[model samples]
Structures are given as C-alpha cells and as structure tokens.
Target: MEGRLENGQYWQGWTVEAPVGVVVFVHGVHEHGGRYAPVAARLGEAGYACYAVDHPGHGRSPGNRGNIDGMDTTVAGVAALVTMAADRHPDVPVFVYGHSLGGLVALTYLTGERHPRVVGAVISAPALDTSASNAVQRAFAPVLSRFLPDLGVLALDIEAVSRDPEVVAAYRADPLNHTGKIVARTGAEILTAATAMPARLRGLTLPLLLVHGGADRLMPVSATEVVRAHAASPDLTVRVFDGLYHEPHNEPEKAEVLTEIVAWLDAHLPPAPA
Candidate 1:
C-alpha cells in the first residue's frame, strides 16, 4: 500500500496475512523505499509486514533532491512511520531496519523519547563517520551549510556499494537512486548527528543488532564497532561479513545476511499472548 505522512510525504508498505510483527525500513540519503521491495517481500513471506518512506527530497517525495533541512527532520520522518506501523498492527511487535544514512536516523530515533515503542532494530552499514570526506570538505561543510546548504560537496564511490558487478550496474541504472554529490547541509547534519551518538548510544537498552561488511569502504566496519562498543543494549549482536561491500544484503551471499536477520527477528519477538 502507498500513502502519505501527516506532512504529505509519500511512503509504501508490504503486508502479509496475520503478520507476526512489522518491520519499517529507513533508506539512505539518495535512495527511496521502493528499492527495498524485494527485501520487504522476503520479510513479508516470513510473516512480517514491512514499510518504507521516501525521505523528504528523495525519490517521489517532494523537496529539493539531495538535500535535507536537518537530522531532526529526518528523525521525525522515521518517527511518523514507526507510529503508522504500530497503529496499523496493534498487539504486534515493531522493528526498524535502517541502512547507511537511515541507520543514523534510526539510531537517533532509538535514542529518542519514542524508542520504547520499538522492540528492536537492525542497523546496517550506519554512516556514523565520514572517512570519505576530505579534510577540506569536512572543514568547509559546516560553514558552507550555513551559507550554501545546497552546495554539493562529495559523491559516493558507487563501486564501494557492492562487490557484485550486477548490483553496481543496477544501482547505477536506478533512476530513483540519486547519483549525485552529497549536499553541504545534509553532510553537516549527518556529521553532527553521528558525532553525538556515542554518548546517546550509552542510554540504549532495547534489543539491537548491528551488521556491516568488513570490506565496506563507504561506512567502515570500525564505525559499527564503535556502536557495538558504546550501545548499552544488553541484547545487542554484531555481525561483520568479511570481504563484503557496503550492501551486504545485496551482495552475492545475501542469503547469509537475510537468514541471520530473520533468525534474530524470531528471537526478539515479543512474548506470545497469554
């Protein structure tokens, strides 16, 4: 199903009959929720409902492409979908799956006031640090964001996305994917938000799973290690797929990641009815 948020931003969902739980996906900076259809469908077949929203300024959503007002706005967007998922499937547990930039947003939301509503979350290749940004880009981003927020500063290394050549080919061909430089303000917001997470992560007590590719160059596995180190979640699990690229789920060995995710979800499901 397709719908709009209170702010009229577009979102989509995939459902299954008598779902055991709901999983909401938060996509990265340049991509839309539609890219996750196959992954969501898999979850649906596993008896879990899944939903995703095109972040403002992304995909079919209305806004200047490749830019965002702030991380607060981004986090609020995730909050809206989380609420929608819970309202649509009351009595069923809800989980969050965030990749890259979305992972940071999900982390911010989990550390926020409404996190208790979520049972657990799967954080994949979170953008917790910007190692790719040159010293000049990092130095200028904040000042530039204040002045020319729309200025494009850095572009992602497309080859770093996945080791599978076909996946890279599809990503390059996907019209919905914004293959452009990261805007100044968006870059600033992501950097600022990520810088604040280590402290906030210490407060997280909910069940959590962090996954990443050991060979990922975009968002390094070390950043995820930092999350594993700081997150206070007693039930946290970390999986590092050595030699895989950024998108482990899209990697040739995707089943390994998906199977682990499903197993984790099964283990974390809320208690059955009395």
Candidate 2:
C-alpha cells in the first residue's frame, strides 16, 4: 500500500499478514524496503505480520536518489509506517527490525517517540559508527551539506556489503537500490546521528536485541558497544557473528542469524490473549 506524509513525501509499504505479532523492517541506506521482502516473508512464516516501507529518496518513494533532507525525515517516515501498522492491527504487539542505517532510525524512534504498542526492537548491524569515511570526509561533510546538499560525497562499496558473492552481485544489480555516492546532507546527517545516538539511547527503556557481524567493515562492530554502554534497556541482548560482513541477515550464516532473531522475538512477545 501507499501513504503520503504531511511533509508531502510519499512512501510505499509492503506487508505479510499474520496474527501473532508485527515486525516492521527498517532497511539500510541506499536500499529500499522491497529488498527486505524475503526477510519479512521469513518472519511471516514465523507468525508475524511483517511491514516495511521505502523511505523518501531511497526507493519507489519520490525524491533525489541517495539523499534525504535530514535524519528526522527518515525517522518520521518509519514512525508513520509503524503507526499505520498499529492502527490496522490494534492490540497486536509491534517489534522493530532494523539493519544498518535502519538500525539508527529504529533506535531514534524507540527512544524519542511514545508508542505503547511497540513491545521491543531488534537491530542488526546498526550504523551507529561508520568506518567508510575518512577524517577529511567527516570534517567536510557538514560544510558541504549546507553549501551543496545534493553533491555526492561518499560511495558505498558493494564488495564490503556481504561475504557471499551472489548477495553482492544481486545488490549491485538491483535498480531500486541507490548505487551512487551518498549526497552531502545525507552523509552529514548520518555522521551527526552516529555521534548523537548514544546519548539519546540512554532514554531507551524497552526490551532490545542488538546483533552485528564481527567483521563488518562499513559500520564497525565497536559501534554496538556504544549502545551497550548508554542504552538503559534492562532487557538488552547483544550478539556478534564472527567473520561476517555488513549485512548479517544476507550473509552466509543467515539462517542462524535469523533463527536467533526469531527466538528473541518469541521470547519477548506479549502473552497471547486468554
């Protein structure tokens, strides 16, 4: 289905219906929600009503490719998606599944917003820290974002996306995936979010499950430690898969990684009505 936000941005949504619970998948940068349809299908088979949406400027939604006005806009996009799911299935527990940049968005929403139906969040390879940019790129991104927001500043390396060659090739061939350099403002917003997220996570009090690839090059595994340090979630669980790349769910050990996710969700899911 499709929906338009108050800011005049249009978003495309996909759903796999079930009754036990809801899992809203938040995709990474340069990628759209459609890329996660397979993952959502898996969750649906586990009895979850899965939901995903393409952020404005990233997928079927219209905007300059590979750019967003700010992280706030992307965060709001997910918030709207979650609200739509909750409104459609009231009383069904909602869980967030975020990967990479989507991880940052999910964390921001959980800590900053108030949504009672949201039971917990599962974030995989969160982009809390980025190793892709150098000191020079980081220093200049903010200034360039103000002066030339649309300028492409950093390019994503497809080879670093996964350990499996097939996954990397498929990602490269996907027309919906933004294969160009990230825009100045988008890069700046991501850097800013990585820096500010730890502090905001202190306010996170919900059940949280964080998983990451031990060898992820794009976003370092050390970033997860920052969440471990600051997030006040009493039920936080962290798992690191050694020898994997940025996209753990798309990695070679995908089954094990996904099984771990479902197990966590099953454990945390609210008790079914009597």
Q: What TM-score fits each model?
A: 0.96, 0.93
Q: Over 4 Å off in model 2, which ranges?
A: 1-18, 130-136
* Model 2 lDDT tens row, 132-164: 789998899889999999898877788999999
Which residue pairs in candidate 2 have backbone atoms (N, alpha carbon, C) closer than 3 angstroms, thus clashing? none
In candidate 2 the C-alpha lDDT for residue 198 amounts to 84
lDDT of 2 at 149: 90
Q: How much is the lDDT of residue 170 in candidate 2?
A: 93
Off by over 4 Å in 1: 134-136
Candidate 1 positional error at 153, Å: 0.5
Question: Could you tell me how far off, in angstroms, the CA of residue 43 lies in candidate 1 after the best superposition?
Answer: 0.9
lDDT of 1 by residue, 1-274 (tens): 9999988778999999999999999998898899898889778778999999888788888777888678888788889998998998887999999999999988999999774558999999998977777778778888999999888888789999888999899888998888999898899999888889999999988888999999998998878987898999899999999999998888988988898999999999978878
